[model samples]
Target: MAAQLPIPIYSSLEDAFGGLRTASGQSVRWANLAQEFKSRFGREPAYIARAPGRVNLIGDHIDYVLFGVLPAAVEHDILIACGPSMSPVSSNSGSVAAHNLDPRYVPQTFAPMLKSAPLPTASEERDAENTVHAESWHMDIDTKELRWESYVKAGYYGVLNHFFPAAAGSTTTGPHPVPVDLLVTGCVPAGSGLSSSAAMVVASTLAFLAVNNKVVGLTKGELVEMAMENEKRVGVNSGGMDQAASVICTPDTALYITFFPSLSAQPTPLPTSRTVPRAVFVCANSLVVSDKVVGAKTRYNLRVVETLVGARVLAHHIGVVLAPTERPTLREVLGRWLGFYEAKNVPSDLDTDMLREGVQKILPYVEKLRPTRDDGELGVTMEEMIEWSGMPEAEFRQVYLSWVDVEATHFQLYKRTKHVFEEALRVLRFRDVCFSSEAAILPRDTLIDLGALMNESHQSSIELCENSCPEVDELVRLAREAGAFGSRVTGAGWGGCTVSLVAEDMVDEFIRSMKSTYPPYKYLGDDELREVIFATKPSSGAFVLKL
Candidate 1:
């Protein structure tokens, strides 16, 4: 006898659209029934999933470094309708809705899943017994989701797999097949650095779990970890904040989250109670897409910090072994071991002696090699130094002392980076103060401060953090001249969107000015650029509603 299948309750299209429109402010006019969504399986839909988009307000290029970031869920979302197929008409049409599902929508498998009975929901007892099996299933789903959708899909699959592997996993040679039809649609802008991608993944995961009647067994921390792992499966290499924000944030409040091995969040109220003098942010496109540079920068930053810290820890261990008479301060020992050459002033003749001498004093705490000094006079550029440290990983691995000594350079780099970061943080705090005070009531002044910070952040990112690109610089310039209060590159830098804080009164004016001045050159022409600028805002994140 066939196992009793969970009865799928399909929401009316009208209800789905109504709930979606209310939540996202996006219209979901169902396409022609016959053309938009045709079932490839002879069964009805059992469930639906909706995911939202997100925007990062601060902490760009810091996620891969395992640093904390502030992100908010936006009003934009991706809505997916999944259920049993009612007909085997090969719903493989070239429609907009079909295109959305193309990435993960496997027509053949979906058709079968719809035909078979839905898997039974796991009880608490069943969950405990199948925890290991469930985890394996989650990993498989994570892998499958990564193939076509954004990293978010990978996260969703991971959670589902961990909680309900039997149903989520694919199978062969079974009379009852696993067929799940997914129809996806969304309004989140792609590649906007708003983390729209992550939001969608998180929302979808929740929706999928809801439909399957599976419960997350882990603590809040474990749940976030699972979500982050799912995202990693998609190869985007992001932190867990986006998923956290999507699931945990509330309207009108910014969430402050700290993520290490686990996730913890608190809502920090906006400084002011009044809505006037609203916080405005603008976005500009850098017109370049170099994921490799962005990814490299992220990895490089992480490696530098780890290497430096690791070297220091190791040096402390070595200190314990040395005899009192022969022992030296960790700093002195490191300086001697790494070949210290000078202090305070790096000499003009930057030979091996100088390089060794310069690194000597701090060698105990250092972890990587400093980039060769640029000229005999000016030291090596920070970017050059970071790139150099990563150059000979294999050779450095062969020699223990050489490797640790070379690794010490990263310690110095991190210290320098931290100083710059501190300044930026100070500026942000000041802005918050200004916004909370009289400036909150004055719209124009608020914009001026916001813009100033935007420019300040860009300068710091370029000179201190070393993450700016020419396109970003150009965008900032264009935005400022066009009456934008402030504009800077968003995301991991090298290339991405630039966000500006503008006045509500001047938004239209600023948009018009930008359109006239920059004229929107590449992929999107002037008209498209105009449209994008007009549409962006500080929006809400993901949510679920009965339709």
Candidate 2:
């Protein structure tokens, strides 16, 4: 049971990082950002918002389908320095002037267009007692091409609609947002699958919330929900894993986040055997950019539709009755197979043993989804899928394909379901090993056990989910040959980064081996290579710095 705590705010760097030792270096970096903000915008910042990127250790594509995932906050993060603007143009209209530390992203200035309609009068409201009146706010976001300020606008859109309603004639009583100037700086590499997009959204969201005086009583869970909804505005239907890990994770532990019953998280300590050498998770970027927005229609979004449709077909095969409008996830389908529905009889606390048993019990039944056609094809066409779904073409398209944009001629229901179930079991097994290890008496093969699970997960991503690419595959191969206990693609696998388990003493040696053996690092200089690959540990999550 995770505690529901409001987002943290600190007056000093020392308090923000929880110690003077940790804050010493950060103080200089943050000070430099503030100084740069002054240089760019000609004013001292009032507040700074920080949010971290995350690396998923296991459970990749299953998160959108509502399964437990293990991910920890990386030390690399995004920071935003913002204050109210005083320009006459900005003062009259709630305009935002945004700049980034990186030159590739040019400066952008935009404002939300408020509606022209006035609010209903008190008597009119009383006359229409059962009716509700609402006005929508509009912000222009280009979903086709990736824009840096689009994320900023997405975050601000949520704040505008939720807090400030646009009504003409000054009839609305709610508060209006102030025009803001923000300077953005970050070390989280973009397109590396470390979730720089989520970090940006979280940091930007927090910046608006803090500047608007809406930070009071905003729980971590609420922030996660807001950020999740905010991120979808930028054109990727991602799971809550990235946003939740960025907001809710604590120091020195990986979060075990479950999504079915309700959004809850547990800070599970990643322990090592006392007898064996200590191990750390190393992130090595493949240098292959995974643009989720550009690739969503064919890769990410297609997988989502396939898995979802697979769940409905599986339920039909299992003699389970599903409403025509219901879109059940693989996890919910498994629950139904186990005789549980809508979270009834679901344990609040995560029981690895029970989850393990449930996966085992359902593994055989999943075979029912195998293609029974004699044509020797491994997948089903759209017509065949609709027929198997036991729904008319109109209803099937409405239920599954209307809300999301996905392009697929063939759907691999069997392969996708098989991978999801097996990968879920692997997650439970991995969690069990982490819990089994103790400081006093540790298993000699602790790292080996954990590494093996990671290896299995990558294989599933490659064969079943089909998200891994040649660059990622070769990178994983080199990592294992270079002495990683277990190495796999960390984030969305089309072209991102890989997380490897390596002994503490051998981290330098492991990096050296990768640099020499991997062709991508051959021409790079020391700093460039360092940025592409490095060692990392679980770090603290998002926070606000009051200047």
lDDT tens readout by residue for model 2, 146-227:
8899889888877877778644335244457889999999999988989999999999999998988888888898889889
Winner by lDDT: 2
The C-alpha TM-scores of every prediction are 0.63, 0.93
Best TM-score among the predictions, by candidate number: 2
Error of 2 at 444 (Å): 3.4
lDDT of 2 at 115: 56
Kindly give the stretch of ten consecutive residues in candidate 1 with the minimal lDDT sum: 1-10
Model 1 stretches with alpha carbons more than 4 Å out: 1-47, 64-66, 84-135, 138-147, 150-153, 165-178, 215-223, 260-262, 269-279, 290-416, 423-447, 519-527
Q: Give per-model CA RMSD.
A: 12.9, 5.4
